[model samples]
Target: MIIKTPRLKKGGAKNVYLENVSHAVTRPAMESRRVQMYLLMLLADTAVLLGSFVLAGGVYRDQWPNEFAMAMGWAFLPIFLVIAVYQRCYSIRALDEVRYAIGQAGIALVLSAMLCTVMIFYAKAATEFSRVMLSLALVAAFAGMALVRVVMHLVLRRIYGPSVSSVLVVMDGGPKVDIRGAQIVHAEDFDISGVQSSPNSLDRIGRLMRGMDRVVVSCAVDQRTKWANVMRGAGVRGEVVSTALQELGAIALEREGGQSFLVVSTGPLALHARIFKRGMDLAITVPAVLVLSPLLLLVALLIKLEDGGPVFFVQQRMGANNCLFDMLKFRSMRVEKLDSKGARSTSRDDDRITRIGRFIRKTSIDELPQLLNVLRSEMSIVGPRPHALGSLAGEKLFWEVDADYWQRHALKPGLTGLAQVRGYRGATETENHLKDRLEADLEYIRNWSILRDIKIIFATARVLVHPNAY
Candidate 1:
């Protein structure tokens, strides 16, 4: 018997899979240099740490470590490993920022030394744990780590000979950039007149991005978001040729002749940061739900009593990775003919809102039910706000208005976000309004921290009754 497989459509899932495999097989050998550098640094760090212990033992006592000191040295390995993870000592971006790497390593070493001290004190073995020796070891560890990093940076630079990233240029009838030592694999002749009507532009971008390290988009201000979305979805760092790049803090700058290029880091948060963020979410969400349980119940009762409609409004919303999930909210509209497409934006004087809905919407009480969504791990307490499937800015759908709009979904949708807290909430009036919202969302992702999340939470109280919430 013979069987036939379905034909793969262009740019379809099967095609994307095959293209990914091809790119993997054909990518330049230099692509893995970053990973190789990371391993080399790790090994170098370990060697220096061990040497630090040996030097400390000899300098402090003129002899090798005793049994307890040897045990402490071995114990330091796993403790330091955990500390390094929290400190992001091994992050790839850390390699790019030597100062950051040194600071993180210092923090890790101090944390590990503290743990050793605590363990020694707990066992009542402080007499055997020499404070002078331990202090010397800690100092040596920090100095050795910093020295290794500086040496490795020099070595890698000499070996690699001034790293030049490969970039794809997407400019709509703009002057070409002259970047030295950088490879321009593809340059699309984008036309501003055709951008809006042309549907295949993104498809062309996807094809051009194969084996590319970065994408450079030089387009009109209006079309920036569209290209940004495309580069983000293609999973490459996106750099726009505009003065706005300078406004974004701490971006790398590359200069060649008279022209300068801004390097954007479009990748997801560091692994350690993501884990830490998720941990923070659970730590806050779990207790928050428990504390707000009574208020949640009361809100539900009020919704149920008002006109006897469904107590909760469950709508399909875009979540992390552009996945769809049912987002929960207290019903905030009169159960009239609801717009299944959610194309209509609510206005202050609009009559679809119920009496209770008006108060809930004003007080942001309608969003409380999303705590349940947070508890289920479908959302975070702080992230980019999710939009309903057919949510609109004007006549066009949200995604239709700006291509990069989907990038906001890279992080799980939140109950409150940077955009919401900054008064970008309520109905989006123009394309620029939605674009600004995306900017805020991306900013949050770029600078995410546990402290930032806490700060946003506290700051949210000030914007709970925002002018735009209606």
Candidate 2:
């Protein structure tokens, strides 16, 4: 994880010697300061919210405390916290920039206060709390929170030396990079490779990335995928330097020191967004399963009676992050003719399908068992549909159709997706057929929202018995 300067030999030749330099490069004392700062800012904002209302109460009514004012503060605190988190008020960027921190905090406070006032008015509790006191509290709270952030920013910069976040740049046979304030290490010096399988190599890489908030890798095009795999589980913001304008599945572009880098790995959704999506999934799936239990049982029984084979067909499909998972479905093919790899596309009047199998496939009853996958978190109620590993488009695999095909796996595969609702389902007969679905899938990922997901679920009802199902 450490590097030493190449020493010159007695004959005036440069001889490069690499050794463990852990003792030479000291680890930052505030390695976990990012989390600490987030907690500190949250607590500071809460304290300010309560304290401001208390102070306002004393000023407005000549009382040291007011019950209504305290209640208002408590109600407003949660709203403010939620808004602030969504606005990135306590993020690393906010921590480093005083103006950004203050602006986001102020906006969050304003929005929360407005929402609280509206709620109180609707609840008919406006008569209990004075408008003048509420206004005063809002003003005081905004000023207090902004002041706290400014002070925190200055303190963090002083304590952590200019940048609160640590960035590590690993150079591995790519262009030389000079990132200001970033610790640079030669990948060769440490014998690092994206395809490396040694435990010691992985451990050393982990040690090098211990205190980093972001790790950037500069490697050859062939090594990008390997490095990406390594960084996906590295527990940090990972980027790969590339000259190409677009890289497969890049989430964003980062420019540093007149050079561009592709942000290859990041959580697709923010924390709050992920919570909302998951909540929606559970809210719908749990009840759907309970309500349709009778129908599900009937179908399972029919399939079992039709064939003495397994009732459910479980095939390995690529899911989020290119990880494979067993995608469940009601077995819709004859037991002896089951194609586990899905190499052959189903055709109308396919002899492999039994009478019940054809009926279920045509009605999409075969897909109902995947609701269990949604419950297992291996799939979502709405996302890009996961494909069988051997599924093909015009004799080529799905991924082989386009490089960005893997990008669709950024989110959990869904029970029904935008592509399916738009009638892009069934056997992909050509490359263009796959491309059409791929475009819709990528579009869905790029503009994902709870509302859109709900719409897709509803639209799917209309396409459940499409002609392509055969």
State how far residue 413 of model 2 sits from its true place (Å): 0.2
lDDT of each: 0.73, 0.82
Candidate 1 regions exceeding 4 Å error are 1-271
Instruction: Give me the runs in candidate 2 sitting further than 4 Å from their true place.
Output: 1-243, 247-262
Candidate 2 C-alpha lDDT tens digits along 1-470: 22323332445421122224332332564546688889988998899989988988889888889777787778778999999999899787898889778877877877887888788889998778688887898899889888998898778767765677677777888887666556676665655543367776666666666657778899999989988877875666798887763446466878999999878767679988899899998999999999999999998899888767889999999998889999999998888898999999998879999899889999999999999998999999999998888889998998899988988998999999999999998899999999999999999998787668988999999999999998
Report the alpha-carbon TM-score of model 1 versus the true structure.
0.51
Best by lDDT: 2
**233-344 per-residue lDDT for model 1 (tens digits):** 7677777777566445436777999998767645667798778777888898888889989988888788789889988888888898889998888888878845555678
Full-model lDDT, candidate 2:
0.82
| Candidate 1 colliding pairs | 229-404
Q: Given candidate 2, what's the lDDT at residue 222?
A: 94
